[model samples]
Target: MRYLIMAEGEGDGELLLGRCAAVEGLFTDPPPPPREVLVLRGCAPGVRAEWLGAASVVGRTESGFEVWWTLVDAEVLSVAPHTGNPALVDVTIGAGVLPDDWHRHADGPFVRFELTTGRGAVRAVTRSATDGLVADRAAAEPLPLRLVGCEPAEPMRAALRKRRGRHPGYTELWSLDDTGRVMDRRAIGFDAEWTRPSVLGGALVDVLLSVDADGLPGLAARPAWRLWRAGPPQRAGSWRELDAAGRHAWLMLAMRRERPAGPDRSGGEYHLAGAGLRDEPGLHCAIGEALLGPGGYYGWGWDALFDSLCGGFGLVPPFTLVWHDFAATERELAGEHDPAAGPGYPEELARELEERGVTVLRA
Candidate 1:
């Protein structure tokens, strides 16, 4: 049987499966997944995971034939399955949740199996993993995430409050040429994206897809968390305070006004894939980081390089740079301009982001 694995783009599309190959007994010893599984790109070839080392298989797991990659564009992923129609199987992959073959990793594995199929020939199955593969990188502690049932806007509201009480309050309005706009704001919730500053000129913060050596999945869950200096903050409960929203809002707003909204804003469906900032190449566009405008803006200082790689890797379509918001404040600014800025930032931080490989728009 020919198994088809569909994805937004052909290049990086295989990453989802590649990770599955990394496990010790997965693709090799025990033949982790059925060796017959096939993979394909669901979107246009020119527009896939061409950057951010899209082809790199950074992490893997044993139990579910399940794998991991950097946060994937949940929006693009929604349509990907339909585009290629993984003939015998119709499984959906996205953020936070595990795929069919995950339970094998459990200490006290559950007992249940689910399989189904739509119009396609392949079958979609969800079951408990009896024998799972274990990859070296899949070692990060399971995320200690808490879900809150509330309007997405509420997190941003709380983030703003935190930013207000913090130092270097939101007083100025930084602008990106036309790409987007941002302001001084912050909030906290489940994801780092809660109360995220305006991004892609109000397009909304799109979840970033990433996989690191730590074996943890990272996303811009909340806009508020986008500006956090550390990983997901430590807040417990449905209604609690998060952290600062960061300081790129004003700079972002300045950029948005300079440009117009993007073309692929909507697919006219209630499902999220069609609305807000569409994927572009060589540029990582986020909603609240005051990042990326009509051309491209640099608001997600940390995500800048990764996004660039995402764009370059073809996960997103190609775009141009219209503006770059350069601001770190008087005291926040690096003491001196070390030509080797990229090297200074930790490798685990953004990897080779600052190296000469990427293109940054200078003020």
Candidate 2:
């Protein structure tokens, strides 16, 4: 959306600039100029005013100063500013009719205008929408990823720092203890940043063995970042040698699989082609029936399979998930069984089982 700003009387430019600054300050990351602005006229009629409120304001003019402000929907102005100047009245201007061009613009609803001048001269100017504003802004600026309250192991910390060095989008690390004690912090980047809870959790698990082997007892991490903890140190040479919990955790870190991205008609584990039938409907029906049968919980999805392995679905321990005709099953589940699609169910189920200290096998 676009908004027009015009000045008519003496000191008009200064007034317009002040108004623009006030409006721009509302956004945490103020957008660039020549961009759409939303103006609230008297009462902001017909507009949702939940984030707005009205108040009177006095500002310097060419003569001495002026006291004027259009009444705004109190509700709409309430939450408008992210910080500072709780008084929404400071950002408002005197009453004026919306320009005729406002209705003509294709993105008219989003565009607004504010004319700062002597109360008498108000004119409407029409112009085409400015192309590339949105794309230009996005390309010029990318959102950052902020890491706050991080207390990673030394190696883990180095790894995180390395990632930040490689990616300019990562904000400076905020080094804090697990108990929310701040050791060091740095400010960089705008306020808006993408946060992925899983990223920290995954990192913690990757360095779990190191933390334990160093004899660092009482080691704790932020609950939100501790997705999976490492099991006790083990010297199991094979899956059968480790205890149940150790085995589960090992498998979780080892096995992982990815599913195909697109649709395929090769059929899944319960397809009827293996039964010598070529009918699609018959195959689908058989597949559905098998999914509802014993040990069929795996058919539901990754979560269900994990639950079954943990005996959450009443399945006993010493569970062995044998993928009969492994290659064919892989082809059906992960289109053509592409290795790039990932380890598929094995990886997913193993992770869940490991989290819960449940042992299971995938063959």
Candidate 3:
């Protein structure tokens, strides 16, 4: 959900990444943030240096107990003999360390680290790998993607030219909703380039960002801006006019809620009109309208919905939510996310409301 890029946090940055189909890493799960190396003394002999692939290694106890480690997705550096004691091998890792799983493979070696379990005392001479520990590998470089468009902002253009491609450094970017609400912001590292905009038909999009990552936030599914650009919905059941994708876009906008300027509007007997309920998004749209008139946002998704029940969203808890025609609404939202297990969405929501001190009347 990229709005025209705004410099810093406000005003136009005068750049358009555009609503292109999902870009790898750009929208989806971004790579984990870069981290420092974590060292674990008394990595224990139970760690199988033989299992050490070209990338990483892990230590374990005989019973297969888990490690006291943090970084699980780590790169294996080497599996050479301990410099001090040639008999004992050391498995040096980088980027991250072993996983701290509650239970590991029963047959695998029980793993432990000195930082947590070891407590600074030397446990014992570690067990030896049947095959000697002997693996050394250099880290692979991150592959950068190329961007071609009407050039980036002044500062971004300069950075691209200066770096020419390697380690150009990172910058913070924000994901905006249709209403220009900041959904989320992330500091991403990118290697940019100056290239002719790829022309298809008669459209042009600015492209000046590229980076490698595992799982960062933002860059969610693109929205159909036409809905909000015409202005916020004013009539009830406005969500019914759009197709499923548009309705989902509406719910997403609700999820990226605008911070209420004043105190929240809580405590009410909100009446929900279920006449237009045909899908999950319709339910959320109706709820928002029921809570705070048309085009209002209470919350979207389970966690956000629960938080909305607490307070701050347009309408809050300690109120009565009279859901009319709920039977039809339930049918529309039945067996969602999973038809095989758990109650229907309506019941789930009712339970959540009841727990939060909201009275739910289903009709």
Candidate 4:
């Protein structure tokens, strides 16, 4: 997939940075997530962790350590001593009690560790690793990125040569297909020095870079993660061309790119190929494709889905959702032993859609 450097911010869409290839970072296996130190202000006095890397203490490290947290049940604020203080880390945790709610702790927990795994947020990661990818390079000038053909506009290139460290930050890079059609857009700040090559024609080729975007790492579940690294599809129906794993990847990529809200199909009937509607993510991928075509963006979670149903995001309400090959599950979408919101997710999903004036046809 080819990529172009567009103007900073989403304001201007016409600007382009020409074409390039052999891009890294965005699609590549992300380096260890930048560690984020969880500062527990107004924490309790006796709060502590069982061990340094304990689940209740440090949480999930970005390096792939695991923890046990669920919606129904709980794992355990399960911390410390990474920096110092070998003192036994003690803490109390309950099922369904998450770290984000650390502030809610009645004892006022003092956080000493961080979830390096970024928890589940691909973008927002833990801070045990300390300095951030971009933050560390803050004082660094120019750019450490070396996109294959990162040729800026003539005017922009001239500016770079005249001023060594002039324009940086919020450098917008748009992933494009072979035909130069934009597939995805990412705005990442360059936190390094950009040494302009002496040659006029030569694009600034100094330093290597990494793209720290969402859904780029820790996707062992999505077998077809490479499908996403290839970038968005040229046309729609991207879901149709995907396998089960690819379907997951499609959702990952789709979640990053926000499709603008426009007029609905005007009370249209969209057919969903619901043959393998196994998980919630799978259902979202198929339904989004059915309504908004390939690489579509309807909503991932319940609250987001409600926003989509309200209107503006592609197909407004009053449309029919023909969910083919439908089958209801006995247990909730959550796994065994985990807390469940209901018996199954389908009924809840249907109830939400129908309430919003959507016609759900289960086939």
TM for every model, in the order presented, reads: 0.19, 0.19, 0.51, 0.57
Of the two candidates 2 and 3, the one with more favorable lDDT, higher being better, is 3
* Candidate 2 off by > 4 Å: 1-299, 336-338, 346-363
Candidate 1 structure, TM-score to reference = 0.19
What is every candidate's alpha-carbon RMSD to the true fold? 23.2, 25.8, 13.0, 10.0
Q: Which one is best on TM-score? A: 4
Q: Is candidate 3 or 4 superior in TM-score?
A: 4
Clashes of each: 83, 19, 16, 28
Q: Model 3, 335: alpha-carbon shift in Å?
A: 4.0
In candidate 4, what are the lDDT values of residues 1-363, reduced to their tens digit?
Answer: 266665554565455534455454454433332234333222223444422231333334334443332222222244333233343332323322222332232232222333221122111123323221112211112223455545456534554564343335356667654445555566654332454342324643432443344323334424434445455554655455555455666665676665665566558788887665555666777677788777777886566777877776767778888877665331323332112224346666788789889999987
Ordered list by lDDT, greatest first: 3, 4, 2, 1
Model 1 over residues 204-239: C-alpha lDDT tens digits?
A: 332211112122212212333232213222231111
Model 3 CA lDDT for position 106: 37
TM-score (C-alpha) between model 2 and the true structure: 0.19
Clash count in backbone of candidate 3: 16
lDDT of 3 by residue, 1-363 (tens): 343233332354333322321223444444443544433333345434222211323356667554333343444455565656765656554553322233343355544433211111122233443222222222323443333233245555455456463233334445554555555444545455543344432344345455444324323333423445445556677667775656766776555545557876667688988766776667777888888776777765556678776666666667899989988887876533244345677778788788888998987
